[model samples]
Target chain A: MKGILRSLLTVIKNTFIRSITVLYPYDRIIIPYNSRGSIRLVVDLDTKEIICDGCGECVNACPLKLISVEKVSHDKKIKNFYVDISRCLFCGLCEEACKKDALKMNFNYELAERDFSALRHDIDKLTEYAKPKVKEFWKS
Target chain B: MENRKIKDYEEIEGYDIYIEPQFRPFGFPVGLYIALKDGVIINIKPEFGYLTTGVEKVVEGMEIDKAIPFIDRVDSSSAISPELTYCIGLEKTFKIDVPLRAKFIRTALCELSRISSHLLWLTRLANVLGINNALHYCLREREEVLHLIELATGSRLTPNFIRVGGVASNLSPRFIEEFRKFFRSFRKNFNMLKTFFLENELVVNRLNNLGVLIEEDAKNLAITGPNLRALGIKKDVRIDDTYGIYDEISFKIPVGEKGDSLDRCIVRMGEIEQSTSIISQAFYKMPEGEIRTYTEDINQFSGNTRSHIECPHGELAMEISIDEGKITKLRIKSPSYNNLLAFSRAVLGESVEDVEVILTSFDICVCEVDK
Candidate 1:
């Protein structure tokens, strides 16, 4: 019985602490480094060209089959890449299967779409989601 | 009692009370039908399968890697347990040894998931019992655990982090630091929970000796995990079967004198402390190594293997057969499936008012049972 009274007092005391609620839109959490928010294409640093050779590996590797890569050149270079974000599971299988590491799961999580067609994006919109990788180091 | 004609009592079965399949607490659709005689529940039947996703049939002939996402989706609350079981089955079939780092990570995640799942159970119970402030406190603490999970695996509920031979990635040092902080503070919160809820006279009177399951009955019905342990039966998958570095760790399993509703609740409270210790030990002994071994051939083995784990609810088992890079057959036996049977048997002869208290005490996951 005394323990219960002590607990009640503790609860009442703790209620005076400032609320930890973050006001959304005014305050937001810093997204982590390896968060699988959205899928994007990785561009090569040396050459001003896309790294994917349009081999359709991501298309085949995708469990949901939400990806399709089209070729416009005779050399099988990727011209247009379509991704149905609605059907994507964000499992990172496609990124793992990519031979050239051209595909990556990015950290941009604000993916609300007003229309269904807006969820289906081509190469340009997908590439725009990619941001520079944040350097992560383990605390010593 | 039999000769008395009660109000609204049908001629066929004394008083046939039916509850339609509705969305119940804990976000699962379930229904209950009971026959009461003189305010005592005489007959009870639980209805389920309202949210079947046909997950088992959908994963047929799926590639080994692709089927994991579906496996992880089997139970959102206990996602890591099913995924870990699936990966263990596949790894056993392929004759691959999981690294020490991966094993430690899996153990830590499994323990954290247990803590969070129990918190969810308590949250729903607190809300049902009108302990609104306790509900918020439980959710607040549970949110801390979920945040730690999100920081580690990038997603809160469905991590999909466990790979076949290892984890999907390495854990950052920040996760360890945060986990230590949470671990230190969780004990005080849990003690308060015990004092406020478990030791309360009203709660004890409501829960004590309401739904009793005998030791023989528990074993005969194949009840497992904490539910079985609540009957004073020393049967745990982690201890009896031994998996995921649990054999290396030293932790005591809590058992109750009589398997009543209150006993079950107390046993779970005991388990939360045990899981915290397990996680701390696993984190301390964690070694530095590769997170995953990129196996080119994951489906080289064709034989079927069954993997079982001591999930938060109870024992969860999975059987997977791989043939040439694809899963030919898959079967899952979740703890809730067995606990539901035990629930039906235990709830008999209890007062009608104690139905919800008895039901929540079992910690039955409708998604796992229905799936």
Candidate 2:
């Protein structure tokens, strides 16, 4: 009975002393330094330039064929390189194939879409979504 | 051992016969221990099917290009490796060779991903063990690595930037300079991780000699990755099988002394150092070349092909059967699948509290296991 009491005390001490569990979302714990969150692509719209050739290379590169690149041409040259984010693998292939470096992967991870159509992002929307900003992380 | 058995009693028959307790009289992570009364475990289980998604089956019927996201979702923790492996497999099957510059960048980013994943795992491990400071420290460093990947590759987690025959494009001069700065930081953080993970008293206490799997056990089960390397065996798919520009850069395959949890951690930590070395070397000697593999004639194998890589997680193997260059059937084999075996061996005889750490030490991904 004495030994049992000692063990119970030890357990209680551990439970109380450890400040391990975080009240997430409210507390919003820091993700590890190298965490892989969500797939993001960057479009430098400040230059008003699209990086994707929209040749559908990423569309072809995907093992699933989920990507749909609908290219809009104004002049003889390309105008808009639209993409279906819903179908995109977020595999970074589009960014990989974006030889112009017009397509980059940004760290903005939260994309909880309400519907499939909402999941889709055209070139214009993608450009708007490509702003670079590191999310605030708590040290403690 | 002696055992005692009582004859069925009339008093217990109508009382609903409480065969098993309904409420788990323990922690959040419960251990399921089922065994024969003859001192043998019929089954030792953890109610660990929560983090499950049919990622593999999701990708099977989809086109090669469409399945990338589903593949990344397999293990949110280390999703990039799976996606990258699949892309490499496609490139090989399609007979596309990327440019020289693209190859260097892929090598750099892939190594960066490796460091990132390791840091995450280490932090998670620390979290479970009540080592808050260690967890925070590791998480901080891991963020920097992710930022570098984002700076270079664009996305923090799901950067599907590595295309077939080449990377989407090359880093700009400014970004390249910043990336070189990241290269130094990666090396510095990796060294810190090595020292902390390998030498920290609490980490050492929690990990070392806690689990034991000898060579024969690992061999019989065909376990791969850091777990296998922990047994002091060097069987990396990158070196042995040869994939990407891994053949180009000089990197060492770090191994450990024992097939214990500590050994596994040590191997992973040492691999981080090796990965860091590979990165710096690749960065400095990053030759001017294509980041992708180009294909002239897409009409190639017209059948099934298997490609393997020594990913940070383990020997990540991918199986894809193509009919006229469109991926028909895709199956993935991750290192976590083999490493899951270490659980029953590691957890048995130990108290239930150690289950989480042991589960973590193996780094078992439920998605990978189910897939």
Highest DockQ: which candidate?
1
**What lDDT tens digits, residue by residue, belong to model 1 across residues A30-105?**
7667778788888876775788888888888888899988897778587899999988787778887888888888
Candidate 2 lDDT over B184-290, as tens digits, reads 66665555455456655656777777767767878887888888888888888888877667877777888888777888787778777888788778878777744
Q: Candidate 2, overall lDDT?
A: 0.64
Which stretch of 10 consecutive residues in model 1 chain B shows the poorest summed lDDT? B5-14
The DockQ of each candidate is 0.38, 0.13
TM-score of chain B of each: 0.94, 0.83
Q: Which candidate comes out best when scored by TM-score?
A: 1
TM-scores for every predicted model: 0.91, 0.69
Over 4 Å off, model 2: A1-140, B1-43, B46-52, B185-196, B293-301
> Candidate 2's residue-wise lDDT over A1-140, tens digit each?
44334434444554565464579768865542323333344444567444455566555655545556554665333454445555444555555455556455454567778787876665556566545556667433
